[model samples]
Target chain A: MTIKQRTFYILRTAIKYVSLLIITFISILPTVSTVITAFKTKEEYGSTNVMTLPKSWTYLSNFVTAWKDANMGLAFRNTFIILVFVLLGSIMFGAMLAYILSRFKFKGNELIRNLFLFATLIPGIATQVTVYQIMHSLGFINTMHGYITLMMGTDVISIYIFIQFFENISLSIDESAIIDGCTYYGVFFKILFPLLKPAIITCMILKGVSTYNEYYMSNLYLQNKSKFVTVSTSLYTFTGPYGNQYNYICAGVIITILPALIIFILSQKQIYSGLTQGAVKG
Target chain B: MGKINTTATKGTILHRLLKWLRSGKGQRTVIMISFMSIPLLLLIIFAYLPFLKMFEFSFYNMKYIGERKFIGFDNYRDVLTDKEVMNSLKLTLYYLLGSFVQLALALYYATMLSFKTKGGSFFKGTIFFPYLISGIAMGFMFRFFYTRGFVLDTVLSWLRFELENLPYWLRDKNVNNMALVATSVWKFMGQNMVLFIGAIMSVDRELYESASLDGANRWYQFRYIILPSIKTIVILNMILSITGSLSAFEPPYVITGGTRGTSTFFLLMHNMAHRHQKVGKASAMALILFGLILMVTIGQKLIFKYGFTDSNEDISQKTTRMLRKQRAKEGKQ
Candidate 1:
């Protein structure tokens, strides 16, 4: 390579590296700030030099107070309840719709497919008012069942994914099962269920992430603070009526987010794959 | 034998009724459909039903102040003239624009990674990790990052930037939406990067090899080969990008609450429903926002012919050609 070409390459490499540095800084700055603030005492939190590190760290103390004050232990139990029902309901319904749509060539099949598509697109806010009123009327408001139902019903995306994968499977398996005297229900569980493991897992992870992260519906429907606080709302308890405790809020945030962060790191690949699968297969 | 035969008739009646449920195909359908029913029913009751109620509520002058009275279209008119709602609409448009700018930046950054360069995977992972974090978590994290993040403050000090003089970023109206948008971009960039990388990887390698052989450099090859190959993905991502932007809520909510004096459409809808108890007006606004999303999505489909489908006739032919070439090479060897 000539000197000119080498120079061109150097400049190109420099430009690329610079862009990467800028992007990384943009992404990391906020997280770094949040993590640092967790250590500073209440006074240091509001210091004029907002960019400086705390003169002292009270990591243990801050976390203890945030946890106890926020009642995160109970909040966690509530989250678990919400997770169990939401996960079960979405998978069952998503896979069920997926099974029929994939297997049956019945009338209005396309229309049903379109319905899921349309539901997924209708910015869920559209139904928030109605859902609230109906839940209130039914006396399910501020209850686990109401929140679970709300989360479960808003699962068209999962169904869409399952149906896509279901279409890819060979029909011969179903046909053979039919020949062996199995009914539709028998064939679904006995034959197709085994083949749909990947899609089911995918739906579980996708729905899991969205459900755990969901604050909108829960915030609306789960109004009784003591009875129904999830991780999202639990973090809000740190901002006491008199003033904001920076250390407490910070520690509370880290604790509140730890489960989600752990799940995210562990299943990072699955989460990305699941989202892309929905995008590509949609 | 006659007595035994009489008992068999009762069994036959039960069997006949459940024949479909007994038959493998029909039974499977029933089981699967039943599984779907709870979720779908939940969706119907909570999601679809509420939407219907919103429509019903829109036609009435629902009031907390007095007796409920029917006032068709008046709610919608009230919403239309409401200055707060109009301000929110403007803010939302700005928010949407901010989001798209970030998406474009993400796409560009993603394409750069597709060169199969070093540290590419690490870069992809680092960027993508944020998308997995909840908006609330990240919002709180940013709360500190903006206020007293250690590394950020240290860097600012090192650079001689006065931490003492730094203005509250989230509190100011001028920078409020921008700050939220930057955060949105950070959260979503990784997801978009992964997608763009996938799109780039799916492009025909021979197309790039041939372009390079013809003395076309990286830029030239990217323009002619890479860009065209990923048009469908680009269009799809763009549609998702724009619509998702218009509905931006979480980060802004966590950052400013509904109190920032700056509210997006969804936030306004939320406030209206929960705080104001103007369900009728809120529903109308929600529907209008939905209508806007619907119009844009349909417009995309019409103009770009982009909707989610796995099969692309264009890509299939290319894959076939690659397969044939590989087989021919094997035969020659």
Candidate 2:
């Protein structure tokens, strides 16, 4: 290569590395700063500059105060309950509906598929007013079951994922099962359901993360904040105009994200693939 | 005689019912209904029902609980003429611009990281970690990060910038939206990058090898090979970003509470319904927003379908075919 070409190549490589480093620094700065602030005492937070190292690295008071003041114990419990029921209900119903839609040649199948497709186009926020009214009429407002049911209700994405998975699985399995005296239900539960482990994992990861991160609907529907504080809503404790305690708020933020952070560290591969696949298909 | 006749009729009906239940058609119907009823019901009640009601509510003047007055088009008029609503709609331009920048950055990074790089996974993990964090936490982090003399200012100070010169990120109307948009871009850019990388990785390696053998530089390979291969996914991301920009909420809602000229269309509607108690007007606004989204989506679909007839084929084939045709023409010349 000519000297000009070599020099240009070096310049390009330098630009790439420098830009990547800058972007990485920007990405992690918020979390790192929050971590630092979480460890500082109120006095330290006020006196020292924001990026200053705490006097001691072993301070636990901020976390203790945040947990107790935010009622995060109840929040964690509620979030867990909601997560378990919502995941189970969504997967079971989504898979069952997908099986029928993909495997069966029933009347109105096309209509049902189109309904789901059209439903996805309507943003959920656009329908909140009437949905709230419907919930109130049904006496479901501020109820855990109501929240879970609404969450499990309109998961067109997960259903689509399941349908795509079902399409790839061979029909010969189902045909053989039927010939061996298995009913349709028997074929689904006893034969096909076990084969859906990977799809289930993908759906769980996608649906699980969204449901965990969900705030708007949870806040609106579960209005009894003190009685029903999910992890997302628990942070509101530090949100009033008079409440500007960054130390405790930072600690609460750390507490709120710990589970997700741990999960990401442990299963980074699965998380990346699941997220990419979800986006691509979506 | 009457008792005997009644008994015979009852037995006949029972036998017919049993026969029907044993039939294949009946079994299929039962299975379909049993499996689909709950999901279908939920969808109708939660999604479709509310969607249809938005239209009905748009035509009537009502609160959450009260008598309804049949007022036609007034809510639409009010929504259109409202300065606050119009300003919020205009502010979506900032988010739209942010999203485009986000896509560009994501594409650049994905291109870089798709090839071999030092500590690629570590960089990937660092960038993608923010996407996994909850938006609420991000709101808090950014609210603090942007406060005067805080994380952002401190970092700038390290670079020898004076703290007094820095603007309060969440307070100043001029740069506050930009700050919020930056937070959003930070939070979501990783997901977009991963998506682009996935698309690029799916491209065949031979094309790159051949291009490299022909003395094509990195930019040339990216332009010819990666760009064409990932066109569909890029377009899809663009469409999603456009809709997302229009519905931008969380950052402003959580951090700034839609203050300082930061409210987008969704936030406006949220305040309209919950704060102002103008359910009718909010419904009208929502329906209008929905209509806008639907029009744009259908327009995109049409453009894709008609404008690029052979876009689905591999770009490498198209390039090579064009090259061969050009060579033949030159030979004739």
Candidate 3:
């Protein structure tokens, strides 16, 4: 190669790394500074600007205060309970619906498909007024089970995702199973459910993340914050007395994000692939 | 020419029903009914019922309780004519502009990292981290980050800019809405990039090698080979971002409390419903927004279907195929 080509390649590589570095820094800017502020003393936060380092890195009071005052234990517990039920219920219903839709030649199949198809078009926020009334009428306000049922009931996208997966799993398997005297239920649970793992994961990732981070609905329905303080709405606790205290607020924010961050880091590979699959299918 | 069952009783309704339940056809019928009922029931309770009720509620004057009088189009009139309600469209435009920048940035980074870039995974993880953070936390974090003489201004001061010259990020109407828009971009930009990367990865690598051999520069390869190949997912994402920008919330609601004129359309509807107790007007506003979104989404779908006919396979199918091939490769090893 000529010296000119080598020089050009070198310059391109440099530019690539530099641009990546800058973009990465910019993306992490808010969180990194929040982490810094979360450990600082109140005096330091006030006197120094946000970028400055604290004298000691082991300041644990803010975290403790945020955790107790925000009732994050209850928050995490509530979110965990919600995620468990939501994921299980949505996956089961979604899989069953997909199975029936994919294999069954039924009278109302087209209607059911279009029902879900039409449901996606209705902006959820637009319909909250009446949904609130429905919940109220059922005496479901300020209840955890009501929230779970609502979440499980509203999961249309997961059904579609599961249904898309069913198309890839060949029908010959089901036929063979039926010939082997397997009931339709056996064919689904014994033959098909195991194969739907990837789809389940995809749905879990999408559904789990949304349910975890769901703020507006949770805030509206879970009015008894002490009883149903989800991580998403838990930080609202700090917006009153400690609202101006940036250190405590930042600490509370960190407390909420830590779980998501950890889960994200550990499952980055699955998350990326799942998100891709979801995007394409969705 | 069918044989009759000797043990079956046609006269007794109960006996015939039990006989039917014992048959294979009966089991299939039972399974079908039971399976179909669950999701269908869920859809009715959560989606359809509430949707119909919302439509009805738009025409009534009511709060959470007491006297839901039918007001006949008055709420719709107010929703259309109210200055604060309509002013949300102007704020939405800022987010629309931000989304474009978000898309451009996402595309740029995806093109760069889609190939064999060093430490690509680390960079991708860092960029995608913010997306996992809850909206409420992110709002609080950014509130701290952008507060006067805070992270943003402090960083600027280190670059030799005077601290006094910096405008209040959350105040000062000229830049406040843009500040809120920037927060949305910060959160979603990585998600868009990852989608683009996945689409780009599914493209045949041989195309790039051949293009390079034909003396194609990076720009030429990107514009012709990469962009055209991943066009479908990109377009789909573009449509999603458009809907997203139209329904922008969370940032202004969380960070600035939609104060100093940063309220997006969704935020306005929320305030109308909750703060002002204008449930009827809010419902009308929500329906109007939904109608606008539906029109835009359907129009885009039409354009996509007819406009981009060259692509044969769906992107999901491609990604699934790629995964299967990877699994096959791994199995052999």
Candidate 4:
């Protein structure tokens, strides 16, 4: 309660808050500037610095130009198709694998699990050179379905999450279902699968975000950018000829970010918990 | 009649096999095999098979196509001795340093926000927003942000600094790597912070209250209580982040195209394979990078195990013992 001690405590608290504020500002600075720039016309962008607020927030020409020029329509469509197929295929495969490995006493059970554990240690990028050749020879180059198939192949995290979840669900559920004249397939699809909603959400958020943000493989394997343009790769349409066109580029960038931003804002709770749970299990 | 029936039944082996297929044991076998086969197959084809192929390709001089020369160990030697490859690896150290900086910041903020703080959730969300963004968009955003006379320069000018005084963030060799690493920290630090926060929140609250009842300060409490509790997760996160930095890509590849000496190992390997058509060399470089990452991961675990041998020490007793010593000294005085 001494004044000197009180002053020092106040100073320390002030520093902590101020430091957090400064970092929060820095974290959002780029996105905020881009948003500001996206609303500017090319002439306005040229006349004003990047930090300047636009005169009118409703300038729609840059967005229109970026949309058409960048072929975002095709990009969104391709990404949508990829997400749909990959999510469905991977979730099914992951849940099914987790069920069998955990529920049934089978031969080579431990061996299959070790195969995946060892696969995790292998750096994925290291093997991509060879993977590229495999895809090429299989005539999977530039094909949307091929990309989806490739995506479904990497389901390690989902399986890990599902397996962790399965440990908590009682085996009596499966036992009773089977005794009630249910096949293993029915026990899974009708009973256990529906109960896996939380785990599915975790996998969905983690896998979905990564898939949506995946640019390297999207750019590399899906080579025909025009036909196979993903939302992530579509932004690169501005890289070559219109590299300095910040107004349109920012517009394009905003367009790409809007969906993810909306989803994040709505599902912040699930995403946070899901991420923590996934991290612990993974 | 019985002999004829037996002979007929024994003769129909295919029918018996079909009958068994409909039985319970057959279904179990079928389901287990079918369920396990798909993921295991995918892992083999996409992961292990390619890993094996990459291993084989490292020994031969080849490209995406054309004739392959079995120049055993030559590619490996070149990868080891190449100055450019080694230099590209040295850039990883900058990222590693940046990542540790990131962890420290995350820990500080996690500690701050773990206690009662204003708008903690809002700050967490804002910081974590970048992680949700695609890497390509971040590259685009920072490209604009760091351009000369752009966002960064304009912001600096407000602080009474001249625009000319600032270096180009992505072009200047000295600061470019750091600049790229900053982008990564901005994008990823939030996630690490969240992880830390989650770990911190799970800690028993009464521990903090009990420590405060003693003459323990915040630093003592953190060092004795929070640090020991969250040690496993913190170390795990550190290992993961270090391994990730070894193959740092996206920022350099996207922003500067690995130009101006900003090329990290993966980006250089990418360029070598696709641009220069040196697949074998690139594969060798990849294997070498993997080995480096493996060594670093193992090295870190060893350090943690040997360096922190007091994993099972009782924090409360240690605090009380120190308190007892201080009281004894005060009594003597």
Candidate 5:
């Protein structure tokens, strides 16, 4: 109610608004800059400042050139194949394994669970030397199937998510089905698989995003870039000493982010919840 | 059943196999094996196998294909003594600082946006958009954004700063890592903010209402109501950020390629393994890095258990008592 208190309140409010605006601007600036740069001609990009608007927004040549030069068509195709197979394979294997681990009172069940728990603690990047060698010995290096197989390896988090979901689904469903002459496989496939839709979506979003955004293994194992260029690797096309073609690079960046951007926009709610759920639960 | 009976008449190997398949235990075993084999095998091959191999490789001096000499602690010694490794490890401090900044910013933003604000969802979407973009694309975006006389310089010039006064962001050793770290913070801060927001939202709304009704300001409400409730997630994010900082790779690897003194421990190990082909040394470095991460994680756990959680419990108890006393006084009135 006092003048001093009123001034302090106004000052605090101003500071809060200013900070929020500044953070938001900082967050969106780079992406916006990339989009603007993508539409610029090479000469225009080189001559003009980065924040300048392009002469014409209809310039589709940079995108076309970036796609052809970066072999992004093949890159996207390869990425799609990897995403489809890896997501399906991970979900099926993760769900089935989670089912067995949660449902069955088998020997070494605790040990298997502990093995997965232990695996989560081991940083994957730290062991790439031996992994690369193992892949090489198995003739998996430079093969799409090899990459897919390696990617299909279920992560502990997804498995835990499935197991958590399975645990919540009462044993009565499986029990009733089995009592009605359903085999164990039938109980799983016919009775339970269809009920795992939420878990499947969460796992799919987690696994699919990682698989789509995966760069390390894809870059490492899939060395035959011309033959196998995932979208992530395709961005490396403009990365040599002589590769300062920002116009083309920005175009490629925009092209690569388009799919993910579209997906995020369409499924913003699911993606946000999925991401937060994974983090919080983990 | 008919086929089994027919095979049983033969009383040979086929009959026994059919007999076993008909048994419940055998069927269960078969089903279990069929379901478990692929995932277990993949786990062993990709996860456990590499880990064990890395441990073994750490003990030998080797290359990708050549004979691995039994060097024992030599690789470990070399890793400890290497100047570049030490320098890169020190560079992790820069990333650690960046992560601290990131956590603070994320906390501030999360607190702000947890409450209703104009266009809050749009701001959330914009902030979180970077987290979804591929790291490779981010590399390209940031590289162009930081280029000399490019996006950053141009924007600064609009604020009366001259392009000539600015340094090449990627090439300057003094600020390149900070630049790289900023990119990482930009990419991840949104996710951290969302997690914080989730934790804050989970707190009881009545607590905030009562606190505000008692004439507490926003800061006091946040301090008393929100902060205590979200302590666990805040700690979790801190631990994640610490470990993440120690293992930073993508930004430096992609945008700067570990140039201009930007390489952290993982990038150095990556370079050592791939570029230099010092697999043995790289393995040692990795094992040491893993050990460091493990030790830090354990230390954090112990600290949280003994130091923060106990004190937090006491504080909550005290607050509850204070609330009870206030309620009693109000009742007397």
Candidate 6:
């Protein structure tokens, strides 16, 4: 390459690498700080000289307190229960809605599609009071069932994603099935549901992560302290009012996210497909 | 002949019934009308029913847990007259503007990533990593960054900025909301980038080539060829940004502990419900917040319709074809 061309190429390459390096550092900075701070003793954390290595590492005391004493254990249990029911219910309902919408032509097809699309814009918090009232009237207050139902049911985004994916399936499959005299219900339950596995997984992860991390609705609905509290809500009670415990707080944060991190690591391959496709299709 | 005719007619009716039950065309109608019964019922009862109830609750003098008295527009009057609420609203508008900046930045980064460059996959992956982390974790992360804590402090001191001299980000009322917005942007930029990148990638590259051949520069190609194509996604992102900004609870709730003295509209609603137990008034506030979001979204849709023309359809089709070819090449590697 000519000298001028080489100079231009070097400048472009340098900009790309330098910008990316800066971005990556900013993104990971928080996590790195949290990990390091978690190892310090109380005094070390609060000391004026915070950047230095802790005077001594206090091994796992924060983790223990955050896990057991701070009530994260109970929070973990509640989160698990919520995720299980919410994930299962949303996937089933969303798939059913998507299946029907993607395949069938009915009188109100356009109306139904518009309704679902419109429903997507209505912020969930907007209807919080009424939902609380409904839950209270039904005596579902402070119950796991109520928490799961509220978080998972009537999700428009998940249903939308499923519909987008379902639309891609060739109509010929349904055509042949109909020609073979299969009922619509039979074809949907037997053939179509199986074919929608990838989409199902996509909605599952999307719903699962959102539901798992959700705090506000759960905080309101699960009023009784002993009955149910997700990880985030539990943090309110974990630290006593006297002073905030940074170590335990860090531990709680880490503990709360560990499950999601594990799940993400295990199913890492499907994640990009699930997240990217869902975003694009959305 | 009569027997044959009768049999054929009977078979056709059965086939029609079967087709109604199974075909994708009829499936939406049947399924919508049939299975949608319970969900629709629940939505009406829970969603709309509560919103109506909220309207009712707002008019009364209601406490957290008590008999509500009928007071016509008194609560609305109070909410409107409260200087705190007004300040909170202004703060919300500021935060909303910050979110827009973040959204625009995300769009730019996403557009760059969508360009068929070498190492695009790695860049995209690094960018989207933050979205996987929860809001709560992100809140904690920011707390560490702002506070004098751990490794960041060392770097700051090395750069000759004394730790004690720098104002703590969360402690200052003026900068608290901005810092929260920065944290939010950090967490959300990745997700928005993914969405916009996907939208741009779905656009046809042929338009760019053609624009170039006509001696149009990169800026013109982006304006005429790229911007119009991603209108729907842009609109969607805007709606999400507005709603998400309005309903921001986690960051402020965690970092400031709602003592930032000025709250976002949703955070105010949350405090009313949780801290004060003003369920009735809180619900009213929530309903009002909902109305604001709805008005903005509808207004946005109207603006889009009036302001923008349909994207060039031929370019879109060509873009789809090019995207498929690109995907095929990736598959081989």
Evaluated on the second chain alone, the candidates' TM-scores are: 0.81, 0.92, 0.88, 0.88, 0.88, 0.78
Better of 5 and 6 by TM-score: 5
**lDDT (tens digit, per residue) of candidate 1 on B1-333:** 999997899788888867855565555466656755665566667656766777778877674346677888988898889988778777766666766776687777887887866787667766777776776777667665655434445676778888676555677677767777777777887788777777777776776665565556777666656666777877777777677767877766777775676577788888787788887788788888888899988887776654444344465465446545655776799
Error of 1 at B278 (Å): 1.6
If you assessed candidate 4 against the hidden native complex, which CAPRI class would it receive?
medium
Whose lDDT is higher: candidate 1's or candidate 5's?
5
Q: List the residue pairs that clash in candidate 3.
A: none
Q: Please, what are the lDDT tens digits per residue for candidate 6 over residues A202-227?
A: 88887877877776677788877665
- The positional error of residue A26 in candidate 3, measured at the CA in angstroms, is 0.9
Q: What is the lDDT of residue B120 in candidate 5?
A: 88
Looking at candidate 2, what is the lDDT of residue B93?
93
How far does residue A121 in candidate 6 sit from its true spot (Å)?
3.8
- Structure candidate 4, residue pairs in collision: none
Q: Could you give candidate 2's per-residue lDDT for residues A1-282 as a string of tens digits?
A: 899999998999899999999999999899989988899998998899889988887998999998998899999999999999999999999999999999999689999998988888887876899999899988888999999999999798889888988999999999998778778889899888999998888889899999999988988999999998999999878887427689889999999999998988888888777766666543
Worst 10 residues of 2 chain B by lDDT: B319-328
**Which candidate leads in DockQ?**
2
The worst-scoring run of ten residues by lDDT in candidate 2 chain A lies at: A273-282
Reference contacts preserved by each model: 0.59, 0.78, 0.83, 0.81, 0.81, 0.41
What digit string (tens of lDDT, one per residue) describes model 5 on residues B1-333?
Answer: 999977777777777778887786777888899999999999999998898889888898889987989988999999899888889889888888989998998889999998888888888888888988888888888888898888899888989998788989999888888899899899989988888888788776766776677666898777876788787778777887778878889899888888878888899999999999989889898888888788877887787778665344465565566666776788799
TM-score of chain A of each: 0.92, 0.95, 0.97, 0.95, 0.94, 0.90
Model 2 DockQ, alpha carbons vs. true complex: 0.79
lDDT for B111 in candidate 6 is 66
The full ranking of all candidates by TM-score, starting with the best, is: 2, 3, 4, 5, 1, 6
TM-score per candidate:
0.88, 0.95, 0.93, 0.93, 0.93, 0.83
Q: State the lDDT of candidate 2 residue by residue for B1-333, as single tens digits.
A: 999999999999998887876786776778899999999999999999999888899998988888999899999999999999999988889999999999999999999999999999999889988988888888888889988888998999999999778888889888999999999999999989988988898887877776776666788788878898898889878887888988898889888989889888999899989998889999999988888888878987897888665553547688666545655776799
Assign candidate 3 its CAPRI class: medium
The residue-level lDDT of candidate 2 at B295 comes to 86
